[model samples]
Target: MENDREGPVPQNGSEGPVPRVGVAVFLLRGKTVLLGKRRSSLGDSTFALPGGHLEFGESFEDCAAREVKEETGLEIDKMEFLTVTNNPFLDEPKPSHYVVIFIRALLRDPQQVPQNLEPNKCDGWDWYDWNNLPNPLFWPLENMVQSGFNPFPID
Candidate 1:
Protein backbone atom coordinates (compact mmCIF):
# COMPACT_ATOMS: atom_id res chain seq x y z
CA MET A 1 0.00 0.00 0.00
CA GLU A 2 1.45 3.35 -1.05
CA ASN A 3 0.82 5.68 1.89
CA ASP A 4 0.62 9.34 1.00
CA ARG A 5 -1.44 10.60 3.92
CA GLU A 6 -0.11 13.82 5.47
CA GLY A 7 -0.97 12.91 9.06
CA PRO A 8 -0.88 9.82 11.25
CA VAL A 9 -2.27 6.57 9.96
CA PRO A 10 -5.97 6.09 10.33
CA GLN A 11 -7.18 3.69 13.01
CA ASN A 12 -8.76 0.28 12.22
CA GLY A 13 -6.75 0.14 8.99
CA SER A 14 -9.23 2.35 7.27
CA GLU A 15 -8.31 4.79 4.55
CA GLY A 16 -10.16 7.64 6.36
CA PRO A 17 -10.68 8.18 10.05
CA VAL A 18 -14.07 8.04 11.68
CA PRO A 19 -15.48 10.74 13.89
CA ARG A 20 -15.71 9.84 17.58
CA VAL A 21 -18.66 10.35 19.86
CA GLY A 22 -18.20 12.48 23.00
CA VAL A 23 -20.51 12.77 25.98
CA ALA A 24 -20.69 15.98 28.02
CA VAL A 25 -22.80 16.48 31.12
CA PHE A 26 -24.76 19.42 32.52
CA LEU A 27 -25.16 19.12 36.30
CA LEU A 28 -27.45 21.88 37.51
CA ARG A 29 -28.04 23.25 40.99
CA GLY A 30 -30.82 25.80 40.84
CA LYS A 31 -29.68 28.44 38.30
CA THR A 32 -26.08 27.28 38.48
CA VAL A 33 -24.46 24.42 36.59
CA LEU A 34 -21.31 22.47 37.37
CA LEU A 35 -18.37 23.02 35.03
CA GLY A 36 -14.76 21.95 35.22
CA LYS A 37 -11.68 23.69 33.95
CA ARG A 38 -9.88 21.27 31.66
CA ARG A 39 -6.20 20.69 32.31
CA SER A 40 -5.24 18.03 29.74
CA SER A 41 -6.49 16.47 26.51
CA LEU A 42 -7.98 18.23 23.49
CA GLY A 43 -9.45 21.37 25.01
CA ASP A 44 -6.95 22.08 27.75
CA SER A 45 -7.45 25.37 29.70
CA THR A 46 -11.07 25.58 28.55
CA PHE A 47 -14.00 24.95 30.85
CA ALA A 48 -16.23 21.99 29.95
CA LEU A 49 -19.04 19.87 31.33
CA PRO A 50 -18.05 16.74 33.28
CA GLY A 51 -18.15 13.98 30.71
CA GLY A 52 -15.94 12.13 28.23
CA HIS A 53 -15.89 9.82 25.24
CA LEU A 54 -18.71 7.33 24.93
CA GLU A 55 -17.48 3.81 25.43
CA PHE A 56 -18.23 1.03 22.96
CA GLY A 57 -21.56 -0.78 23.47
CA GLU A 58 -22.52 1.71 26.21
CA SER A 59 -25.75 3.65 26.24
CA PHE A 60 -25.62 7.43 26.15
CA GLU A 61 -27.17 7.70 29.59
CA ASP A 62 -24.77 5.13 30.94
CA CYS A 63 -21.80 6.95 29.44
CA ALA A 64 -23.07 10.19 30.92
CA ALA A 65 -23.44 8.76 34.41
CA ARG A 66 -20.11 6.98 34.27
CA GLU A 67 -18.17 9.96 32.92
CA VAL A 68 -19.55 12.41 35.49
CA LYS A 69 -18.64 10.13 38.37
CA GLU A 70 -15.22 9.35 36.95
CA GLU A 71 -14.37 12.99 36.45
CA THR A 72 -16.13 14.81 39.30
CA GLY A 73 -16.65 12.20 42.01
CA LEU A 74 -20.32 13.15 42.36
CA GLU A 75 -23.30 11.02 41.60
CA ILE A 76 -25.84 12.54 39.22
CA ASP A 77 -29.50 11.74 38.72
CA LYS A 78 -32.59 12.74 36.73
CA MET A 79 -30.76 12.82 33.46
CA GLU A 80 -32.48 14.45 30.49
CA PHE A 81 -31.46 14.59 26.89
CA LEU A 82 -29.94 18.01 26.25
CA THR A 83 -28.45 18.59 22.81
CA VAL A 84 -25.81 17.46 20.33
CA THR A 85 -22.82 19.12 18.74
CA ASN A 86 -20.40 18.47 15.88
CA ASN A 87 -16.87 19.59 16.69
CA PRO A 88 -13.86 19.57 14.40
CA PHE A 89 -10.34 20.21 15.65
CA LEU A 90 -9.05 21.93 12.54
CA ASP A 91 -6.57 24.16 14.32
CA GLU A 92 -4.77 21.25 15.89
CA PRO A 93 -1.70 19.76 14.28
CA LYS A 94 -3.51 16.44 14.14
CA PRO A 95 -6.90 16.14 12.54
CA SER A 96 -9.72 15.16 14.87
CA HIS A 97 -13.51 15.21 14.74
CA TYR A 98 -16.15 14.52 17.36
CA VAL A 99 -19.90 14.46 17.70
CA VAL A 100 -20.69 15.42 21.28
CA ILE A 101 -23.84 14.46 23.15
CA PHE A 102 -24.82 16.77 25.98
CA ILE A 103 -26.81 15.37 28.86
CA ARG A 104 -28.48 17.34 31.65
CA ALA A 105 -28.31 15.83 35.13
CA LEU A 106 -28.95 16.71 38.75
CA LEU A 107 -26.81 15.87 41.74
CA ARG A 108 -28.15 12.82 43.59
CA ASP A 109 -27.82 14.98 46.71
CA PRO A 110 -28.13 18.70 46.20
CA GLN A 111 -25.71 19.36 49.05
CA GLN A 112 -23.00 17.09 47.70
CA VAL A 113 -20.23 19.27 46.36
CA PRO A 114 -18.09 18.22 43.39
CA GLN A 115 -14.45 17.18 43.62
CA ASN A 116 -11.86 16.91 40.86
CA LEU A 117 -11.33 13.18 40.80
CA GLU A 118 -9.26 13.24 37.61
CA PRO A 119 -6.73 15.91 38.40
CA ASN A 120 -4.86 15.24 35.16
CA LYS A 121 -7.99 15.92 33.09
CA CYS A 122 -9.55 18.80 35.04
CA ASP A 123 -8.28 21.66 37.15
CA GLY A 124 -11.36 21.76 39.41
CA TRP A 125 -15.14 21.69 39.39
CA ASP A 126 -17.30 24.67 40.32
CA TRP A 127 -20.86 25.80 39.98
CA TYR A 128 -21.53 28.82 37.80
CA ASP A 129 -24.58 30.77 36.80
CA TRP A 130 -25.73 29.80 33.31
CA ASN A 131 -25.76 33.37 32.13
CA ASN A 132 -22.41 34.17 33.71
CA LEU A 133 -20.22 31.31 32.56
CA PRO A 134 -16.47 31.65 32.68
CA ASN A 135 -14.56 32.66 29.56
CA PRO A 136 -13.01 30.23 27.04
CA LEU A 137 -15.51 27.42 27.13
CA PHE A 138 -14.69 24.20 25.29
CA TRP A 139 -15.65 24.20 21.61
CA PRO A 140 -18.69 21.99 22.01
CA LEU A 141 -19.92 23.98 25.01
CA GLU A 142 -19.27 27.26 23.24
CA ASN A 143 -21.27 25.93 20.31
CA MET A 144 -24.09 25.03 22.68
CA VAL A 145 -24.07 28.49 24.23
CA GLN A 146 -24.04 30.17 20.84
CA SER A 147 -27.08 28.11 19.89
CA GLY A 148 -28.85 29.37 23.06
CA PHE A 149 -29.17 25.95 24.64
CA ASN A 150 -30.26 26.53 28.22
CA PRO A 151 -29.86 23.89 30.88
CA PHE A 152 -32.97 25.08 32.70
CA PRO A 153 -36.27 23.55 31.82
CA ILE A 154 -39.01 25.89 30.65
CA ASP A 155 -41.65 26.11 33.27
Candidate 2:
Protein backbone atom coordinates (compact mmCIF):
# COMPACT_ATOMS: atom_id res chain seq x y z
CA MET A 1 0.00 0.00 0.00
CA GLU A 2 1.24 3.43 -0.83
CA ASN A 3 1.77 5.60 2.23
CA ASP A 4 -0.59 8.57 2.15
CA ARG A 5 1.02 10.38 5.07
CA GLU A 6 3.68 12.83 4.04
CA GLY A 7 7.09 12.83 5.64
CA PRO A 8 7.47 14.83 8.83
CA VAL A 9 7.54 18.53 8.08
CA PRO A 10 10.33 20.67 9.40
CA GLN A 11 9.11 23.04 12.11
CA ASN A 12 11.85 25.27 13.48
CA GLY A 13 14.39 22.51 12.79
CA SER A 14 12.14 19.93 14.50
CA GLU A 15 10.13 17.34 12.61
CA GLY A 16 6.38 17.40 13.15
CA PRO A 17 4.54 14.18 12.51
CA VAL A 18 0.90 13.13 12.31
CA PRO A 19 -1.43 12.57 15.24
CA ARG A 20 -0.31 9.89 17.67
CA VAL A 21 -2.71 7.28 19.01
CA GLY A 22 -3.61 7.10 22.70
CA VAL A 23 -6.14 5.53 25.05
CA ALA A 24 -7.98 6.99 28.04
CA VAL A 25 -9.56 4.59 30.49
CA PHE A 26 -12.65 5.68 32.39
CA LEU A 27 -12.35 3.54 35.49
CA LEU A 28 -15.79 3.67 37.00
CA ARG A 29 -17.00 2.63 40.44
CA GLY A 30 -20.57 3.55 41.19
CA LYS A 31 -21.15 7.16 40.09
CA THR A 32 -17.50 8.11 40.45
CA VAL A 33 -14.62 8.00 37.99
CA LEU A 34 -10.89 7.86 38.60
CA LEU A 35 -8.75 10.84 37.60
CA GLY A 36 -5.17 11.90 38.13
CA LYS A 37 -3.58 15.30 38.52
CA ARG A 38 -1.28 15.63 35.55
CA ARG A 39 2.27 16.78 36.35
CA SER A 40 3.81 16.90 32.89
CA SER A 41 4.48 19.71 30.44
CA LEU A 42 1.51 18.77 28.28
CA GLY A 43 -1.75 19.63 30.04
CA ASP A 44 0.07 20.15 33.30
CA SER A 45 -2.03 20.57 36.48
CA THR A 46 -5.19 19.22 34.86
CA PHE A 47 -7.15 16.28 36.15
CA ALA A 48 -7.31 13.59 33.49
CA LEU A 49 -7.92 9.89 33.02
CA PRO A 50 -5.15 7.33 33.45
CA GLY A 51 -3.84 6.65 29.97
CA GLY A 52 -0.98 7.09 27.53
CA HIS A 53 0.19 6.62 23.97
CA LEU A 54 -0.79 3.36 22.32
CA GLU A 55 2.00 1.11 21.12
CA PHE A 56 2.17 -0.56 17.73
CA GLY A 57 0.43 -3.97 17.42
CA GLU A 58 -1.41 -3.58 20.73
CA SER A 59 -5.19 -3.74 21.01
CA PHE A 60 -7.17 -0.90 22.55
CA GLU A 61 -8.21 -3.12 25.45
CA ASP A 62 -4.62 -4.12 26.04
CA CYS A 63 -3.45 -0.53 25.98
CA ALA A 64 -6.16 0.52 28.45
CA ALA A 65 -5.37 -2.34 30.83
CA ARG A 66 -1.63 -1.69 30.69
CA GLU A 67 -2.00 2.06 31.12
CA VAL A 68 -4.42 1.74 34.03
CA LYS A 69 -2.12 -0.72 35.79
CA GLU A 70 1.01 1.31 35.10
CA GLU A 71 -0.49 4.66 36.06
CA THR A 72 -2.73 3.70 38.98
CA GLY A 73 -1.65 0.20 40.01
CA LEU A 74 -5.17 -1.12 39.50
CA GLU A 75 -6.13 -3.92 37.15
CA ILE A 76 -9.06 -3.61 34.76
CA ASP A 77 -11.34 -6.62 34.57
CA LYS A 78 -13.22 -5.60 31.45
CA MET A 79 -13.74 -2.58 29.23
CA GLU A 80 -16.06 -1.34 26.50
CA PHE A 81 -15.27 0.98 23.65
CA LEU A 82 -16.79 4.37 24.36
CA THR A 83 -15.69 6.85 21.70
CA VAL A 84 -12.80 8.14 19.64
CA THR A 85 -11.66 11.77 19.66
CA ASN A 86 -9.63 13.74 17.19
CA ASN A 87 -7.76 16.28 19.29
CA PRO A 88 -5.75 18.99 17.59
CA PHE A 89 -3.97 21.43 19.85
CA LEU A 90 -3.03 23.99 17.26
CA ASP A 91 -3.62 26.91 19.63
CA GLU A 92 -1.83 25.47 22.60
CA PRO A 93 1.69 26.53 23.53
CA LYS A 94 2.94 23.03 22.71
CA PRO A 95 0.97 22.23 19.58
CA SER A 96 0.27 18.54 19.08
CA HIS A 97 -2.46 16.15 18.01
CA TYR A 98 -3.75 12.79 19.23
CA VAL A 99 -6.29 10.24 18.16
CA VAL A 100 -7.65 9.23 21.55
CA ILE A 101 -9.71 6.12 22.16
CA PHE A 102 -11.86 6.36 25.25
CA ILE A 103 -12.71 3.16 27.08
CA ARG A 104 -15.03 2.55 30.02
CA ALA A 105 -13.63 -0.13 32.35
CA LEU A 106 -14.28 -1.90 35.60
CA LEU A 107 -11.70 -2.99 38.13
CA ARG A 108 -10.82 -6.66 38.50
CA ASP A 109 -11.00 -6.30 42.27
CA PRO A 110 -13.50 -3.80 43.55
CA GLN A 111 -11.52 -3.28 46.72
CA GLN A 112 -8.23 -2.61 44.95
CA VAL A 113 -7.13 0.89 45.88
CA PRO A 114 -5.34 3.08 43.37
CA GLN A 115 -1.81 4.34 44.01
CA ASN A 116 0.44 6.92 42.44
CA LEU A 117 2.71 4.62 40.48
CA GLU A 118 3.95 7.35 38.13
CA PRO A 119 4.62 10.29 40.41
CA ASN A 120 6.60 12.02 37.69
CA LYS A 121 3.69 12.12 35.25
CA CYS A 122 0.89 12.42 37.81
CA ASP A 123 0.67 13.75 41.32
CA GLY A 124 -1.98 11.32 42.59
CA TRP A 125 -5.24 9.60 41.83
CA ASP A 126 -8.70 10.19 43.22
CA TRP A 127 -12.32 9.53 42.48
CA TYR A 128 -14.75 12.29 41.55
CA ASP A 129 -18.44 12.48 40.91
CA TRP A 130 -19.16 12.09 37.22
CA ASN A 131 -21.20 15.29 37.20
CA ASN A 132 -18.58 17.32 39.04
CA LEU A 133 -15.14 16.74 37.62
CA PRO A 134 -12.29 18.91 38.85
CA ASN A 135 -11.20 22.06 37.14
CA PRO A 136 -8.86 22.21 34.10
CA LEU A 137 -9.41 18.87 32.46
CA PHE A 138 -7.15 17.70 29.64
CA TRP A 139 -8.22 18.97 26.22
CA PRO A 140 -9.77 15.70 25.00
CA LEU A 141 -11.61 15.26 28.28
CA GLU A 142 -12.86 18.82 28.19
CA ASN A 143 -14.06 18.26 24.67
CA MET A 144 -15.87 15.11 25.72
CA VAL A 145 -17.59 16.93 28.54
CA GLN A 146 -18.64 19.79 26.30
CA SER A 147 -19.98 17.33 23.76
CA GLY A 148 -22.14 15.77 26.54
CA PHE A 149 -20.72 12.29 26.10
CA ASN A 150 -21.43 10.42 29.28
CA PRO A 151 -19.30 7.41 30.07
CA PHE A 152 -21.97 6.13 32.48
CA PRO A 153 -25.35 5.85 30.89
CA ILE A 154 -28.31 4.23 32.59
CA ASP A 155 -30.00 1.41 30.75
Candidate 3:
Protein backbone atom coordinates (compact mmCIF):
# COMPACT_ATOMS: atom_id res chain seq x y z
CA MET A 1 0.00 0.00 0.00
CA GLU A 2 1.28 3.47 -0.83
CA ASN A 3 1.20 6.47 1.50
CA ASP A 4 -2.42 7.22 0.85
CA ARG A 5 -3.54 10.05 3.09
CA GLU A 6 -7.07 9.77 1.74
CA GLY A 7 -7.33 6.75 -0.54
CA PRO A 8 -9.95 4.09 -1.08
CA VAL A 9 -9.90 1.04 1.13
CA PRO A 10 -9.48 -2.61 0.34
CA GLN A 11 -12.43 -4.95 0.89
CA ASN A 12 -10.67 -7.26 3.35
CA GLY A 13 -9.05 -6.58 6.71
CA SER A 14 -5.67 -7.54 5.26
CA GLU A 15 -5.06 -3.87 4.45
CA GLY A 16 -3.86 -1.49 7.14
CA PRO A 17 -6.36 1.23 6.52
CA VAL A 18 -7.35 4.41 8.29
CA PRO A 19 -10.56 4.59 10.25
CA ARG A 20 -12.10 8.03 10.29
CA VAL A 21 -15.52 9.18 11.53
CA GLY A 22 -16.88 12.55 10.59
CA VAL A 23 -19.91 14.20 12.23
CA ALA A 24 -21.84 17.03 10.65
CA VAL A 25 -24.49 19.20 12.25
CA PHE A 26 -27.40 20.86 10.52
CA LEU A 27 -28.41 23.85 12.60
CA LEU A 28 -31.83 25.04 11.73
CA ARG A 29 -34.02 28.01 12.54
CA GLY A 30 -37.30 28.78 10.80
CA LYS A 31 -36.27 26.65 7.81
CA THR A 32 -32.96 28.47 7.48
CA VAL A 33 -29.79 26.47 8.09
CA LEU A 34 -26.26 27.47 8.79
CA LEU A 35 -23.59 26.63 6.21
CA GLY A 36 -19.85 27.04 6.14
CA LYS A 37 -16.95 26.83 3.72
CA ARG A 38 -14.21 24.27 4.21
CA ARG A 39 -10.76 25.62 4.81
CA SER A 40 -7.33 24.05 5.40
CA SER A 41 -6.33 20.85 3.59
CA LEU A 42 -9.60 18.95 3.96
CA GLY A 43 -12.53 19.07 1.59
CA ASP A 44 -12.95 21.59 -1.20
CA SER A 45 -13.48 25.31 -0.85
CA THR A 46 -17.17 24.69 -1.54
CA PHE A 47 -19.92 25.22 1.04
CA ALA A 48 -20.64 22.48 3.58
CA LEU A 49 -22.50 21.64 6.74
CA PRO A 50 -20.66 22.57 9.94
CA GLY A 51 -18.88 19.57 11.39
CA GLY A 52 -15.57 17.72 11.38
CA HIS A 53 -13.75 14.48 12.05
CA LEU A 54 -14.30 12.84 15.39
CA GLU A 55 -11.48 12.46 17.86
CA PHE A 56 -10.51 9.07 19.22
CA GLY A 57 -13.10 7.63 21.59
CA GLU A 58 -15.54 10.42 20.89
CA SER A 59 -19.20 9.52 20.44
CA PHE A 60 -21.01 10.73 17.34
CA GLU A 61 -23.12 13.03 19.47
CA ASP A 62 -20.10 14.34 21.30
CA CYS A 63 -18.23 14.93 18.08
CA ALA A 64 -21.17 16.85 16.72
CA ALA A 65 -21.30 19.03 19.80
CA ARG A 66 -17.57 19.66 19.83
CA GLU A 67 -17.33 20.38 16.13
CA VAL A 68 -20.25 22.76 16.20
CA LYS A 69 -18.58 24.62 19.02
CA GLU A 70 -15.11 24.56 17.49
CA GLU A 71 -16.28 25.71 14.08
CA THR A 72 -19.17 28.00 14.85
CA GLY A 73 -18.58 29.12 18.45
CA LEU A 74 -22.23 28.39 19.15
CA GLU A 75 -23.46 26.16 21.93
CA ILE A 76 -25.89 23.48 20.79
CA ASP A 77 -27.98 20.94 22.60
CA LYS A 78 -30.41 18.15 21.62
CA MET A 79 -28.38 16.68 18.78
CA GLU A 80 -29.92 13.96 16.67
CA PHE A 81 -28.64 11.81 13.85
CA LEU A 82 -29.98 12.99 10.54
CA THR A 83 -28.05 10.71 8.20
CA VAL A 84 -24.77 8.92 7.57
CA THR A 85 -22.65 9.12 4.48
CA ASN A 86 -19.53 7.24 3.39
CA ASN A 87 -17.48 10.25 2.48
CA PRO A 88 -14.08 9.52 0.98
CA PHE A 89 -13.30 13.00 -0.17
CA LEU A 90 -12.05 14.00 3.25
CA ASP A 91 -8.90 11.89 2.91
CA GLU A 92 -7.22 9.87 0.20
CA PRO A 93 -5.55 7.01 2.06
CA LYS A 94 -7.20 4.05 3.75
CA PRO A 95 -10.68 2.81 2.90
CA SER A 96 -12.46 6.13 2.70
CA HIS A 97 -14.35 5.74 6.00
CA TYR A 98 -16.90 3.62 7.78
CA VAL A 99 -19.44 6.29 8.64
CA VAL A 100 -20.20 9.99 8.56
CA ILE A 101 -23.03 10.80 10.96
CA PHE A 102 -25.07 13.86 10.06
CA ILE A 103 -26.71 15.44 13.06
CA ARG A 104 -29.55 17.93 13.23
CA ALA A 105 -29.21 20.25 16.19
CA LEU A 106 -30.94 23.28 17.55
CA LEU A 107 -28.66 26.23 18.11
CA ARG A 108 -29.20 27.94 21.44
CA ASP A 109 -29.47 31.67 21.10
CA PRO A 110 -27.83 31.81 17.69
CA GLN A 111 -25.75 34.91 17.23
CA GLN A 112 -27.06 37.55 14.92
CA VAL A 113 -24.32 36.68 12.46
CA PRO A 114 -21.93 33.84 11.65
CA GLN A 115 -18.42 33.61 13.05
CA ASN A 116 -15.42 31.39 12.43
CA LEU A 117 -13.70 29.56 15.25
CA GLU A 118 -11.40 27.07 13.48
CA PRO A 119 -9.64 29.36 11.10
CA ASN A 120 -8.01 26.44 9.36
CA LYS A 121 -11.19 24.41 9.13
CA CYS A 122 -13.52 27.10 7.78
CA ASP A 123 -13.18 30.52 6.26
CA GLY A 124 -16.67 31.92 7.01
CA TRP A 125 -20.28 31.04 7.76
CA ASP A 126 -23.70 32.09 6.56
CA TRP A 127 -27.35 31.39 7.18
CA TYR A 128 -29.79 30.39 4.47
CA ASP A 129 -33.10 28.68 4.12
CA TRP A 130 -32.57 24.99 3.54
CA ASN A 131 -34.42 25.32 0.25
CA ASN A 132 -32.26 28.26 -0.83
CA LEU A 133 -28.77 27.07 0.10
CA PRO A 134 -25.85 28.06 -2.05
CA ASN A 135 -24.77 25.71 -4.81
CA PRO A 136 -21.35 24.12 -5.49
CA LEU A 137 -21.31 22.66 -1.98
CA PHE A 138 -19.79 19.32 -1.17
CA TRP A 139 -21.92 16.64 -2.80
CA PRO A 140 -22.93 14.90 0.40
CA LEU A 141 -23.93 18.13 2.07
CA GLU A 142 -25.96 19.21 -0.91
CA ASN A 143 -27.80 15.93 -0.80
CA MET A 144 -28.57 16.38 2.87
CA VAL A 145 -29.95 19.84 2.29
CA GLN A 146 -31.95 18.80 -0.73
CA SER A 147 -33.45 15.82 1.04
CA GLY A 148 -35.13 18.05 3.62
CA PHE A 149 -34.97 15.25 6.11
CA ASN A 150 -34.68 15.75 9.83
CA PRO A 151 -33.72 12.88 12.07
CA PHE A 152 -34.85 14.65 15.18
CA PRO A 153 -38.30 13.56 16.18
CA ILE A 154 -41.02 16.12 16.40
CA ASP A 155 -43.91 16.25 18.79
RMSD of each: 5.9, 6.0, 5.2
lDDT tens digits, residue span 1-155, model 2: 00011122344566555677778889999999999988866677888998887878999999899889888889997799998888776666556677788899999999999999888788899999999999998777887899888999577
Estimate the TM-score for candidate 2. 0.87
Tell me each candidate's TM-score. Answer: 0.89, 0.87, 0.75
The residue pairs found clashing in candidate 3 are: 4-93, 5-93, 6-91, 6-92, 6-93, 7-92, 7-93, 9-95
Report lDDT (CA) for all predictions: 0.77, 0.80, 0.66
Q: Taking the tens digit of each residue's C-alpha lDDT, what string does model 3 give over 1-155?
A: 00112444454665655555677777777677788777533455778778767767888888887777777778887787766776555443223553577888887775545578766666688887765667777667766556776543576
lDDT of 2 at 122: 84
- RMSD over all Cα atoms, model 3: 5.2
Q: After superposition, which runs of candidate 3 have C-alpha atoms over 4 Å from their true positions?
A: 1-15, 40-42, 90-95, 111-113, 145-155
Error of 1 at 97 (Å): 0.5
TM-score of 1: 0.89
Count of steric clashes across candidates, in order: 0, 0, 8
